[model samples]
Target: MRPPDFEARMRAGECFHDVRMLPAAWAVLRLDGHGFTRFTGRRYEKPFDAAFHDQMIAAAGRLLERFQGLYAYTESDEISILLPRGWDLFDRELEKAASLSASLAGSVFSIACGEPVQFDSRVWLGARDEDVVDYFRWRQADATRCALNGWSYWTLRKAGRNAAEATAALHGKPVGFKHDLLRAHGIYFNDLPLWQRRGTGLYWERFAKEGFDPIRGVAVSTIRRRLKVDRELPMKREYGLLVGRLMDGAGSGDSRRTA
Candidate 1:
């Protein structure tokens, strides 16, 4: 075969497995930090760390901007970004979407934290509005469960319990037991920061920018967009409503009106 013909034959095999997302479906790209337990154990406080939380928020914001996401949630070294139905990034190719997003998140977070990190990505396609809401609600529920377990484990370890002992103390324990375990140590799970229990949310907001209009010779107020970091987020059904509102407003390019 000629050189041009040979190249064309190889390209066909390279593109054979590529897949694209449905044009009418919503996409949630979830990126999770790889080997983060050891990564954070070396650099951050046990149970919860504010600096790490802030870094995650920064990374999530970068992703939201790059992907034009409608909403983003971060908790425990993972981020889930909600992209609207018509999102056409990378021509909606699943392989490109997953790999590029993961690479970007790892790079942004590593720069912010001053350490190298890696992230793995996956896409969740939702066929309806309720599917998206339920997806986030499920993630928030997991966040609450994780916070309870972490606080319980670290509290035990701080009080002289070894690794195995701490795990034993919390293994198969009920939620009430975990809550009481912390209470006995003067740590109330409910009083911990909301972000620890419910995770943080990032979305867009619009503000008025004042500038002089050269042609009119008068100051003009123009609406501009910025990312808003939300450390306080609602839980359960209320959170579902928040997601629904964001989804509805995203189509109209009016995420600003969602308070």
Candidate 2:
């Protein structure tokens, strides 16, 4: 019962949409973010300990293996997945994996060190593997530095910088007087590990990308509060919010239904 004009349309080079749709089985999938210990005082010799990194790798691998045939990538702290179209409940699987990762992280070095960790997961529709790769690369190359600059600024200010008095000069509101303080300490954001610097920068850049102007340097107390907001809760909620939004969008008539 093919439409009478279907064959003719195909021969004439007609397409259903401007974008070429992939065959039915393929889908865009991903998980991003990582669990980490708060390094508030006395830098941990190495920004991220080797043992924690290994455990995260292992946890991600377990999830990847369990989801065989799904195109996968683990770049930086995020995990990307390209799933089969028929697998409708990928969120459930993601939740399971995230929960396991947190548990695994707890048993690892962060716990004994008195540092709590947090992570987040997200998936994109109509996204390509390269998109995911580029996103993470941006994180590594640029975003990390912002995070460091922000944190360093805050750290220095907390150590006693005239933060309140210097508010307008920094950006707008007072953050921490870290920039000036760090300068006194002879520590600069560029001196940190390249990856770590990216983490610092990217975290602070979130507001900018969303069209909001950044406050001076990052607010140490504010950034700490944000970190706590993200970390204090069990990690799965970030993923859950993404999943919920996707489901809501899909059900809404406003969204295109090509996939």
Q: Pick the candidate with the highest TM-score.
A: 1
Candidate 1 matches the true fold with a TM-score of: 0.94
lDDT of 2 by residue, 172-225 (tens): 433245455555667664464443443211000111112222564332221110
Every model's TM-score: 0.94, 0.37
Give a tens-digit lDDT track for model 1, residues 167-206: 9878899999999989999998999999999999998877
What local lDDT score does residue 105 receive in model 1, on the 0 to 100 scale?
A: 97
lDDT of 1 at 182: 96
Error of 1 at 159 (Å): 0.7
